[model samples]
Target: MPDILAVLNGVSPAWFLIVAGLLAWGAPWSPVRKALMLIGPCFALLAWFATHETGVYGVIDLGPFQLETFRFDSLSRIWVLVFILIAFINGVYALHERNRMTDGAALIYAGAAVGAVLSGDLLTLFFFWELTALASAPLIFAAGAPMAHRAGLRYLAIQVLSGVLLLAGAAVWASQTGSWGCDAIGVDSAAGVMLLLAFGVKAGFPLLHMWLPDAYPKATGVGSVVLSAFTTKLAVYALARGFAGEGALIAIGLVMAVFPIVFALVSNDLRQTLAYALINQLGFMVVGVGLGNELALNGAAANAFVGVIYMALMFMTLGAVLHRTGTVKATELGGLFKSMPVTGVCAIIGALSVAGVPLFSGFVAKTLILSGAHYAHNDLAYAILVYASAGVMELSVLKVVYCAFFGEARHHQVREAPQTMLLGMALAAFLCVYLGVDYRALYELLPFGIDDYEPYKLNNVFGQVQLLLGGAFVFALAVGFKLFPLKSDHTILDADWFYRRLGDGAARWGKAMGELLVHAINTALTAGVARLRARLFNLFNPAGALSREFPSGLMALWTAIMLAAVLLVSYFSPMS
Candidate 1:
């Protein structure tokens, strides 16, 4: 094992993914399949740790291209570690899956995300940026439905466009700075805007976030877990690296934190609502990153790390419900605790954690971000973030657990989730508790030292608890008064509409123009053919060629006379 570890230390992240892809392609039912699935991510984690002491990855220069990058910094380590853990957990969740395509796509997606974070150059980052698109597209298609297919296409288009923007930004930045390495390039130029837009699209920043909710709910159970971890976090990391303190991101972050709460409030599909909620959670981290202070950046990093765990925990609980009930529509689900007590309990823990209840993972992580907001002295932003936090509790953690599980078992015969699923949820639930109670390890892993960071301050803890309870009270009041807005039947418009409708519109317009051009060409061709035919007929059937004229000899003599007259006329005309 030591020798193997030594040998593995020399391999690149890309090579590890390639090997995983090959295994996924070749061995569909190998008994060692489960072990093989985790190898790539484990390798990535090892690679990340190998660079921890050095604080950066060794630079590899390809002639004029220099890659000044680090594999395991404080920021990158947390994310990469979460990515690995997500892969491992998702693999466990998906162990019973029979779809090789789904498994393959999941592995590639995980590996690509890990590679993206570990990239040392802008060119390398762009490579993995596009790889994420290629890997995740199949997960959407793996749903095996028409809606999934359409959603997959739209998702692919959005991701590809993001990749294009990233590449364009990399090109511009490389030209201007004469290097392709990943550094703290300021966001004061066109290149910076392009890069920001690219990350924004991936981060699901406000209107650009349509692809997330549109596609995530449609993915398979395991697919949703995988989707929850990588793409947006990568965008946050990029923003942390490239656009920190840009001021623009502060506004962008504000919009991100607030808008999704409204949509989540009105959404019917439980998973879709969670998707909206997910964006809101990301918004807090985005604001922290934009603040660009040590505490703020550390909060953003910590939020992202804990957010992945809690997000996965939430999704797993919901997914288990969907798996057992065959539906996740909150309107249709109620009273499931009798059959699924274990899952129900696990879900409640997840919900409380997300709600930032006093002693859960969310409490430890989210408070860091809220404190950072307070430190930044953006009272308006802080207030909105506070409101959004309560909104998350109201819509997701509280509503999902109370309405879906504990209310009333709408269907009495519903079986508890499979033991495997419960086991997975339990593991995640344990992490949520362990991390919350003992967060010293997590805090130390943050890039900046927070010697004075205290999450247990009375004002902070009581304030967050008050918000949660107040939100819960409001929910109760709304339910009691029948004032809660019922879930809408129609799909609310999202950023994906541009690609779905706008792309469709552009395609329709192009087809119309093509038909017009084809008709014009056909008409011109027909006219040309008609003129040629007429000319040929006139040449073949000249006048006075039928029997109405005279015999052949008479006709010949007349032709000779007409030729002589023509010659005489020409001679006279010239001579005169």
Candidate 2:
């Protein structure tokens, strides 16, 4: 057999899991199938660990171009590690389920995302890009509900459109630049514009963002956890790779970061709330990419890294609630801290991390971006990022913890999640604290190695604490004023309303108006035809004009006079 390390060096870790995922459907026994799910990621992690240096690894020479499968560099290293970590955690989380489709689709979706991250060229990236879209759709579809079915179809359409845009942009780029490499192609060219749009579609750029919040919450509980980690982050990876430092992204990112607060405030479903907050969290990272300094890039990478864990931790906790309680809607849930104390604690930790409270993972990661914005002298953007960091994410994500676990006991008899699920949340929760407190581990994995950026400085910690307190106060004020939606049954129409309801409504209205117009026109035409028929019958029917005919001689004389008159009229006519 070939050397293990050598094999790892040459193969992308994704193949190990992708192959295993394909084989999972054929595994005759449940035990062996589940084992494959766990083992696949472990071996992929081993492959990730085995690589010692950064360069292209698996280069395929297909007739016209070379496909670089594993570009294990600093930037990709962080994303790949986090993805592999999530895959393993998700596998542990999903161990209780026996659905082969979810099992296979989740693994393949994850592996495809990893493969896309490690892709060195546009050609290779596009191939894996489409794969992720295809693989992840079934996870949403597996929810076995009409809503999930519709959401899954929309999700697939949007994702496939992103892939098409990517391929088109890459083709245009190759024509202009004569290479398929995915280095920093800025927004000055047409191809760059297309590529930014493609990535933006996935990155949750405002208006292009409906696909995320629409589908993720509607997916199966385990599916939501898996869906949360990969697709959007992959878009961030693409943006960092291609459109870093584009000034326009700063404005776009802020819009993305800020707008979700309103929707989250009114949302009823905890999972759906988290889905909106996902867009909010990603905006900060997008800003980091736009700022595009080493510090900003590192911040983006760090945020993306920890964002995965904390966000998944939050999703995992909510998923657990969904698992036991059958609903993530706030109106139908309350006060579960008694029975689900462990999950409640985990939820609180996840909330703290999301809120960027001091000594949590979010604080450590967000500091880099805030500092990056400050050092870059982007005061306005810095202020916005700071406010969004403190204000939006805290209120949005923390509500899940409060309403579901600590509010009021609407679900008293609900038991704890399965063992495997708790273990998943446990692993994710531990990382939230560990990465926050010991941020150097996360910093070291950044695209830029950890520099003099100390997150634990007196002012940094104090400021974040102050911000956290202020945000808490606002949340409390909102609650006091009855502005916070702790237990709502409302279906808040977000940007998604335009497509899901508004667009559908418009089409229906148009069809009704067209039918009305046609009916009116048909009525007028029928009336006119009836009037003409009656006039003709009155004038020339047998008992009308013909019954009053004169004698033949008088008729002949009249005819001769009429013929002379006709001849005179014809002679006078211009045409004659």
**lDDT scores in order:** 0.78, 0.88
Q: Please write out the lDDT profile of model 1 over residues 416-482, one tens digit for every residue.
A: 8887778778888988888888888779888789877889889878788788888888888876787
Candidate 1 TM-score over all chains jointly: 0.87
Worst 10 residues of 2 by lDDT: 546-555
Candidate 2, residue 394: how far the Cα is off, in Å: 1.1
lDDT of 2 by residue, 513-560 (tens): 999997786565546355655655566767666434433444455678
Regions of candidate 1 where Cα sits further than 4 Å from its true position: 1-18, 55-70, 391-393, 487-489, 521-526, 529-576
Which clashing pairs does model 1 show? 57-70, 334-408, 335-408, 335-409
Q: How many residue pairs clash in each candidate?
A: 4, 1
User: Candidate 2, after superposition: displacement of residue 131 in Å?
Assistant: 1.0
